[model samples]
Target: MSDHPHPPSFDENILKKVEALQEKYAAMGQDLNAYLDGLLHADYLTYWDYINLDTLLSLQHPITPFPDESIFIIYHQITELYFKLALHELDQLNTSASKDPDLILKRVSRVNRYFEALTHSFEIMVDGMDQDQFLKFRMSLLPASGFQSAQYRMIEIRSTSFDRLLREEVREKYEDHAPGDLEELYSHIYWKAGAVELATGKKTLTLRQFEVKYDRTLLELAENTFEVNLRSLWNGLPVAAQTDDLRQALRWLDTNVNINWPLSHYKSAVRYLQRDPEDIAATGGTNWQKYLPPRFQRRIFYPELWSEQELANWGKGWVEKEVFGVK
Candidate 1:
């Protein structure tokens, strides 16, 4: 005690933590001192750095001089981030070993919540931007369109079997191939029909550019998710887990993605771009009148879950009234 000053009595909690850390490192074939050295050099994490606030705020590089252009960029970036979040949940659903119903419901709920947010906020696109500026700036973005969003495509792939996402005609055509053939499966996806030239029925520059940039990656993703998609995973759940609540949740998710979101988006297009007599073509040069409306596409993610009437109704009456002003 006199020589070493009582050896500097340590707190019991601190001593216990140190001993636990030493044992943990020992079991892992590491030295606690080596980790302590690294910790000594580590910088304290800041909120800005932890969230990458600076880099995230720097992403909105609008081409035009209009202030609203930044809004457009930022909103799409936000949407993509939401899509990324949804994909994170989907990935967890796809990889889970147990296929726990509670977990699946939780994840699908998250994805639906994200889509619901987008659906509700699509008014930002319809009304937030000045029409004149949006029209003017849209010309600067020639081939790039929301249709080109690869993450959106990935979400669809993870949500259902590729066959369900295809037009029945397209599905029948590819029925000869092995069920999981990536190239064949993706060839029939419904979105391939979008962004086409109405006059010539050829692929639009928008579609061509999208294919060039994403076709390979999409094929790979489709291959990976072919058997593990949301519908397949849901079918794998215990019969008790397919309760009415869960069924309604899944149905809402299906309609949110395939109908409600698209319908809202189509309304925005109509609001901004639908000039009477001859509506302005979309920036992507598609027959968006045909492409954007859900009734014409009828892209259902889960077919067996819906009855004949629901399938027949699809996106019919409500969409016609809201989007096209039909009686």
Candidate 2:
């Protein structure tokens, strides 16, 4: 034999794979040879091409010429992308054929990881930009606000019972409301309060635009995930699989999304928007004081996992230490 191994022929593994592909294409009435030819001609994917990096980089078209405006735009885009990843994990769990607690634990942990990454990266917004640049460029953007992030809303809608997302004021009233009344109940969703004009107590143009675009989609998601959401799924799981680790994972998720995440935003708001007794309105005219603080919303995803004290204190410690500097 030559020093090199004999030129390879179609080995058993290669032949088996080819046969499998042939059968796969045959089942769909496709010619495997045609696909093989196309595959042969296709260029190998590069990192940039695979991710559309150029397209993604080109997306941040700031309305103003300020350099920091790009930072603001890119950061929000990144936040939305992470929210999409979280929703992807939730979607898989919600639509799964079986309520596997291990899967729930795995997916929820993944969402937690995404949120933690976001919470840490939020430092970019908190300190990276010059406040003057952000304040000026933001004005040119008009009634658009991060509050309009539909994916974030979808994540909440798919996380728990629809009523959990409603404000405490109307939640009791609408908790038992029929599915047919989704639209009516949505009218009182907690986030709608976040976008009101502080002076007038009226819907800001930002909220109106968000509602018009997302209300139907959010309602549909709420209905579809009604029985399959995390809270409902946990309720239906067998006692054996409802392990302590799983409960802890969910509690972490609840804290990550509701408490830690919002407090980070509230921290940033205090950095950029906080003034003495009179603070500046956010670009979208949102009341950042009321909106960013978790103590105000008190939104929780899995309540049964938390105790009365935890619920009562909800986000109070973080606000005290980070925002108020009350060591």
Candidate 3:
């Protein structure tokens, strides 16, 4: 018969992959042919279905009729998504047995990129909203402040030593504390002061609500990440492996998160809430004046990474330039 030899069922590479997959499934006590049959019958994946696009679009149900509230909701949703990406990078390092400095640098670089995006994009929150609509609708969503973001708190916990997160006034008291002392330390966590009711000297309903939902979970994460958090990992790195690029990334991350981000919020607060007679109280009575400025918190994730003068001048220049239009 005039014919080329019948073509082999699959090319050599495909056949090799199938063989490897069969071996893999056999090790796991699976029937490879059954899995192959399921794959053969499966529908082609659509982009929207793969990403759950319809479900994601349906999540925003603004509590008030004000159209600007929709902007607020969507922007916060976008922020949480970015935070999720940052944590995903950190979690890989935290869970891995390898303390390879290059891996840490790679993940840190990715996280820094995410925060840079967030810091730049915060202009949307600052200037995009109709302040009148925002102030009107924001009250309807009272006691529920952006201060209640558990993911932001989780980023702090995952980023550095828990002691670094303590209020400056109380941090010295717990300077020599042990791991079991997390409860006491957490009680004085810096952000809590920001969430207090100005007149009553008590925790705001916003902070109280957040504590109920996240206290145990966050404490557990803190305990688990104690040895594996970014600061600890950086400290553990051999001096030779601590490249200048890595140091720069870490420093940029600290500035982006602690200074630039808070100042961005401060800018938004002044834009909407600052008034002629008396500046408006923020949602949930958050002490924005006390809370949003970096000079007050002075929360340095990596103290050893800075000079004494740098530490003294922390958050000062950024605040003057961004908040006050200083040169």
Model 3, 227-262: lDDT tens digits are 888988888888998889888888888998898888
Q: State in Å the error of residue 34, model 2.
A: 3.5
Which of 1 and 3 is ahead in TM-score? 3
lDDT of candidate 1 over 32-130, digit per residue (tens): 999999999999999999999999888778898999999899889889999999999888765766377777778889999999999989889888999
Candidate order, TM-score descending: 3, 2, 1
Regions more than 4 Å wrong, model 2: 1-8, 27-29, 96-98, 276-285
Model 1 misplacement above 4 A: 1-9, 96-98, 172-177, 180-182, 276-284, 324-327
Which pairs clash in the backbone of model 1? none
Model 2 over residues 228-300: C-alpha lDDT tens digits?
9888899888899899989999999999999998988888888887754333644455576777789888998
Decoy 3 TM-score against native:
0.92
Q: Which portions of model 3 show Cα errors greater than 4 Å?
A: 2-9, 26-30, 95-98, 276-284
Instruction: For model 1, state the Cα shift of residue 43 in Å.
Output: 3.2
- lDDT to native, each model: 0.83, 0.86, 0.86
Greater-TM-score candidate between 2 and 3: 3
lDDT score, candidate 2? 0.86
